[model samples]
Target: MSSSLLPFILFALVASISPGPTNLLILAHGAHNGLRASLAPIFAACAAAAAIVWVVGLGLGEVLLRHPLAQQVMSWVGVLWLSRLAWQLFRAAGEPLHATARQRFGVGSAASLQLVNPKVWLMAVAVIGVFATPGLPVWHLALVFLIIALPCMGAWALLGIGSARWLRSPRHLQRFNQLLALLLLVSAWSALLA
Candidate 1:
C-alpha cells in the first residue's frame, strides 16, 4: 500500500470511531433495537458521510469556504434537529425498550443527519484538503472512508447490543436512554460553541 493511504486510513478510523452524535445515536439505537435493526442506520450514516467527502472533493468544499453563512445556517438547523431528537429520546426514557419502535432512528434520518451535521461536513472538507492528492482521487478517499466508517460505527452498535444485556430492567434502560440523550445534546451544541 502507498504510504499516503496509511495516514488517510488512520484518519478515517479515528474520525469514525470517535464518540460523536452519530456514533452515540447508533450505540443508543443498537441498545434499544438490537444489531439486526441497527444495521440499516449504520450503513446509511457511513454512506452519507462518504457522499459528503465525495461532494466536498468535487468542489462543495470551495463553495462552503466561500460562503461562511451557509455553514452557520446548517449548524443552526443541525443543532435544532439534534436537540429535538435528544428531547424525544429523553422523554421516552421511561418507556419500555420495545415501546421505542415509534421513535425509530432509521436510514433516512441517519442520512439526513449526516447532511446537516457540521462536524461531518468539516471532516469531509478536512479529508479532501489533507488527503485528496493528485494520485489519490476524491472518489478513492470517499470509498475508503465508507469502508472504514462502516466497521467503526458498527463497533458502536455492537457496544449497544452488548449493553442490552444489562439494560433488561426498565429503570436501567431509562437511565441509559437519558444519558445518551444528554450526551447527544451536548455533542450537537458543542459544535456551534466550538
Candidate 2:
C-alpha cells in the first residue's frame, strides 16, 4: 500500500467507525432485529457513503458548502428528519418484537438519509479536499471510502447484535429501545444546535 493512502484510509476508518447517526441506527436495529435483518441498513449506509464521496469528488459538495443558504437548508432538513426518526424510536418500545423485521431501517431510507447527513457530506468533502489530488482518481478514492466504511459500520451493528441477547426480556428490550431513542434525540439535537 502507498504511504499516501495510509492517512486517508486511517481517516476514513476513524470517521466512519466513530459513533454517528448511521452507526447508532445500525446498533439500534441490530439490537432489535439481529444480524440478518440489520444488514440492509448497513449496506444502505455504505452505498450512500460511496455516492456522497463520488459527488463530493466531482466538486458539487464544495459548491453546496460554500453557499450558506444551502447549508442552512440541509441542516434544517436533517434536523427535522432526525427528530421524526427519534420520535419513532421512542415509540418503538411499545411495538411487538415480531414487527421488528418489517420495521427495520431499509436500504432506501438509509441511502436517502445521506442526502441530509452532514457528517457524510463533511467526510466526503474533507476526503476530496485532502486526498483527491490530480494523480488519484476520485472513483478510486470513493472505493477506498466504501471499503473502509462498510466494515466499520457493520462492526457497530454486530456489537449491537451481541447485545441483543442481553435484551431478550420484553421489559429489558423496551428499556433498551427507549434508551436508544433518547440517545437518538440527543444526537439529533447535537446535530442541529451544536
Candidate 3:
C-alpha cells in the first residue's frame, strides 16, 4: 500500500474498533444471550456498515457530508436512540434471566437496525468519506473495509463473551448493565456536543 493508503487503513481500524453504540449493543447482546447469539447482530452490523462505506466511498455519502442539517438530524436521531437503549439497559439491570430461545441473537431486527444507528453513519462519513480516496477502485476500497471490519467487530463480541463470565451473578449483571447504560447515555450526550 502507498503511504497515503496507510492513514486510511489506520483510520478505518480505529473507527471500527473504537467503543460505540454498535459495540456496546453487541457486547450487551453477547452478555445477555451468548457469543453465538451475538454473532448475528455483529455480522449484520458489519455488513451494513460495509455497505454504507461502499456507498459513501462511491460519492453518495458526499451529499450527507455537505449537508450540515442532515448531519445534525442524524446526530440527534442517534442520541435519542442511544438514550432509549440506555434506558432499557438501566431497566434490565434487575431482571432475571429466563434463557429463552428467542433471546439468542439472530439475523433479525438487530441487523436491520444499523440503518438508523448513528455510530455506523458517523463511521461511514468519517472514515469512508474522509479517508478513503474516491479515485480508488470501488472493489479495492470494499476489500480494505471488509478486512478491517470483520475482526474488529469479532473482537468486540469476544470481549462481551469474556465479560459474561464475571456477570454470572444477577446482582453483578445488574450493576454492569446499569454502568453500561450510564456510559451509553454519556456517549449520547457527547454526540450532541460533537
- Tell me the alpha-carbon RMSD of every candidate: 1.1, 1.8, 2.3
Clashes of each: 0, 0, 0
Task: Please provide, for model 1 over 157-189, each residue's C-alpha lDDT reduced to its tens digit, 9 standing for 90 to 100.
Answer: 999989988888999999999999999999889
**Candidate 3 wrongly placed segments (more than 4 Å):** 99-101, 104-106
Among these predictions, the greatest lDDT belongs to 1
lDDT of 2 by residue, 1-194 (tens): 55558888889889888877778888988877788877778888898888889988897877877896887788788878877887787787866566775787888888888888767776787888888876667898889888988889889889888887877687877887788878777766676675
Give residue 73's lDDT in candidate 2 (0 to 100): 86
- Better model by TM-score: candidate 1 vs candidate 3: 1
Q: Global lDDT of each model? A: 0.91, 0.81, 0.73
Show pairs that collide, candidate 2. Answer: none
TM-score for all models, in order of appearance: 0.96, 0.91, 0.86
Q: Report the error of model 2 at residue 183, Å.
A: 2.4
How do the residues 7-57 of candidate 3 rate in per-residue lDDT, one tens digit apiece?
Answer: 777877987798877777777777777777777687787777778777877
